[model samples]
Target chain A: MMKSWDPRIEEMPKEDLQRMQYRLLKSLVYRLYSFSPFYHDRMREQNVHPDDIRELTDVKKLPFMFKRDLRDNYPDKIFTSTKDELVRYHVSSGTTGKPTVVGYTQNDLNTWTTSLARALTSVGLGRGDVIQVSYGYGLFTGGLGMHYGAERIGATVLPTSVGNTERQIELMQDLGATAIACTPSYLLHIGEVAEKMGVDIKKDTELRTGILGAEPWTDRMRTRIEDWLGIKAYDIYGTSELSGPMFTECVEQKGFHVWSDIALVEIIDPKTGESLESGQKGELTITILQKEALPMIRYRIGDITTMDDEVCACGRTHPRIQRIQGRVDDMLIIRGINVFPSQIEYALMAIPEVGQHFQIVVERKGALDDMLVRVELTKESFSDKINDIIQVRQKVEHRLRNSLNVNVTVELVEPGSLPRFEGKSKRVVDKRSL
Target chain B: MDTQKFVIRQISIFSENRPGRLAAIAHALGEENINILAFSIAEANGFGVVRALVDYPEKAHDKLFSLGYNVAFTDVIAVRMKDQPGGLYEVAKVLGDAGVNIEYSYAYSGKEGAVLILRVDQVDEAIKKIKNSGATLLERSVFH
Candidate 1:
């Protein structure tokens, strides 16, 4: 039978949930307008006021908050709450710009933990379940966020925050860990390390559920992990800005259930800032209604996905968002065609000869964009014959061309030479910018 | 008529076409005291397959594999042909007439004679046809 951490709020009627969301959204707007100078000025510039927000959909009038806003504010300049009320701080190390800081009050932490508690419970995890968190612990929110959520659901937290894979596998077996929360790439690395250590995770370990997120992964990858590791790998969604990893797909594995009372999610045309109807693909915009230290109203998350309001089979009335397609910032234009690294990963996963590690190098030659995919040859698929290796490369190139609608140069590297990550894996190296 | 005795194991290593790669592979093999009797490098699309008839095929494979090289063993037959003209045609004609397809062939001239290493689609058929054609086929002992 399906279990819920807070069924009163989780299984609430659709109309009641909407009513609650509207009230929370209205109160959050009024509070932000009264206290936050940043939001106050942004609302004035956008010609929006708290009184104008009569219905929830009127949130479209609020100016969209962006990563740059956080970067511009730097170290809590935009935080509405004072330093005394803030109990925790999580900073995302930006690759290019100044790191964005997110402060949370004690109440904010509870809301975040409660959100994950319901999420973890929806995925059928509860007491007697040992969750080994493999995400990076310090600064990064994945480890602590999952740690609190797993603990709140009455599950024993393993606290194995990334690296030491062989040791982690040993502890996983010794402690009899039942679930693990980590990035998908890190989990793949763990599986590889376990195989090298001669430990068969499927037969030897008690790990049955994987709450994998923090990097965009594909459905095909989910199938591969499930079939290979004998675990139901569920996609968890959130960023450091959203109080770490928040929601996850339940046992049904269709989409991630976004608890409506905590946050409001909208799909918007990223180019025009116009909201798209449900089921239409667009950028994911979210408004955190209950946050105190950092309340995000219409924060543009820069991820592309569609929304579904249909009730989940798991009996949750909250709306569900499909698996993240790709980040808008991660999208690359090759020869004037938009390409996502996740799309390349999805295409490569279908081929048997290609291993899990691959790097996409995009360079500008003369006038045209040249894309080269350096893929590792799996140990199982290595061939001694030159013709066989040639055929494999040709097959990979053909498959990529067919799927991406662009010609790609494929270079086969030795297995285990590609970089493996304990955190988010940087797969794309666009030399065009250089 | 015993063609099984003529089959020799050749170690093949996958290598990228980069500077010092061949040297690294040779150094690893030499550290294990393995001798490369006859070898051929096949190039395709920025990569090469270094196929060599080593004295200890299994040992060389294990050594290279331990050094993180992708190595495998293939069964190839060595046919002793005339060092002069038409020696390759003599063995080639026999295999072609017998419907044995030669996937690849590399020859080396030594004190013994010009021995043509043949990787055929039909290994047993090619061995039997070459043996029946009155040509001298080198046994595994000759290479080992």
Candidate 2:
């Protein structure tokens, strides 16, 4: 059966979608230039003015915003609203240096909540489903973002947050929870813990659907989670700056449909900053159409993916992305070969002997670059026999070499030897000094 | 005879091959009042394995483990030999002729002459060979 949370916008005609975008983009540009000095200076430097944007094509005249710009303006310089206007805000823990802060007015919060609710409904989650939001809460937008969306959908929401896997399973079983929202990695972790406790989630619990996002995961990982928890796994995509988890995969599991009425999405060539044709892979750029407290104009999101404008099987007209490939910063180029850690993760996860805990170490040896994948063997796969262990390591090495098209050295370590992360995990350690 | 009483449990700790790792292990065990009677360190690649005979093998294993060191116990035979030249060769030759491969071996001297610790592929067969050769095998009680 097909369903939609907002049929009017979801089924809007192609011309109407473009007309709506043009109307929002023209005003958004003029408003930002008038209110936010950051945008005004950037537009001025680019020799663009509010009068320049007359048609949708004129959006190309506006300046692009990057993470560096956000860092340079830190705190509240980028905000269009004053202190009295912002009802709530979230700050990203920069980890490197200065943090990027985003503010939200009451109307902006309502839009964010509705956008998320629409995303959730597209994936067949609504009232009567007990959803357990397991994404971490607080400064990170993932937890509360999904929490309010589930509540807005009228679905019973259990704000379980993250961690305490054993008790999480108990609550799910006892409460008959039908859905869960968390990082795909954490969902898999809960499944592992459930298995240890002799609880077969697939057969014993009522979990039927999982809303997973915040980290790039492979289709293979989705299948693994679905098999483990007996749930339909859907990919949700968003950034803290633009509002968390605004796009999600429909029941078809084809791609995540971006809510074009609220946010404008474009795929651009990362190096050239030129927009690419539909079905062509490039860096994803987003612009908030209705955001008031902090509007983003042509914001380069750093994610790489292709956009499909074709009408979906579920009857939604909003353009969908063909899965997030990888972040531009997360891509590694070794000796003319481009490889993504997520690809390596997919290859490793497909092998039953290899556990999820693995790290890629890139070092320079003489003039050549070397990539060493150090992964841990599952406890059951860890054997005392030297020949058996060697064969396992060789199998992993051969699999990686075949998949990546690059010869990589695979080192097998003991279980629990590699580092584990609660949030977005760091899988690469580059020592090339290049 | 209970093999637990006769067999000497040698604690082997996996450590990175760097300075102060051995000293750290020594200090940790010493703090627990667990004396390391005889110890040998074998290193390969960038990691070293510290195999030691302590007064209480279980106690030392727990102490080393709780102190954040990867430690395990292996049952090794401690055979007493005359503290003279070729004392090791005599014991090695017997185990070699018995077709038992010696993975690793360490030696230490005490008031009761020299004792050689042997970690072989076949512990039972090597024990039989030592018994037949009249080489005195030091039981766990002798360490006490």
Top-scoring candidate (DockQ): 1
Model 1 clash number: 0
Candidate 2, which CAPRI tier? incorrect
Interface RMSD of each: 1.2, 5.0
Provide DockQ values for all models, in the order shown.
0.37, 0.06
Q: What is the lDDT, from 0 to 100, of the residue A395 in candidate 1?
A: 98
Q: List the residue pairs that clash in candidate 1.
A: none
User: How does candidate 2 fare on TM-score?
Assistant: 0.63
Q: Name the regions of candidate 1 deviating beyond 4 angstroms.
A: A331-434, B1-144
Q: Which candidate comes out best when scored by TM-score?
A: 2
RMSD of each: 16.7, 15.1
How do the residues A1-434 of candidate 2 rate in per-residue lDDT, one tens digit apiece?
22788899998987899899999988888888887888888999999998988888777777788866776778878788889999998876332324578889998889989998888898888889999999878877888888999999899999998878899999999999999998776787788788889999999999999998776668987887788678999998887788767888999999998877888888899999898888999999988999987788899978889999999888888899978886777766554234667778777778998787789998766434689998766645643234455677789999888767567888765456679989888889988652
Estimate, for each residue in B1-144, the C-alpha lDDT of model 1 and write its tens digit. 677899999888888888888998899989989999999999888788899998988889888888777788888999999999899889999999999888888999999789999998899999888888889889999878
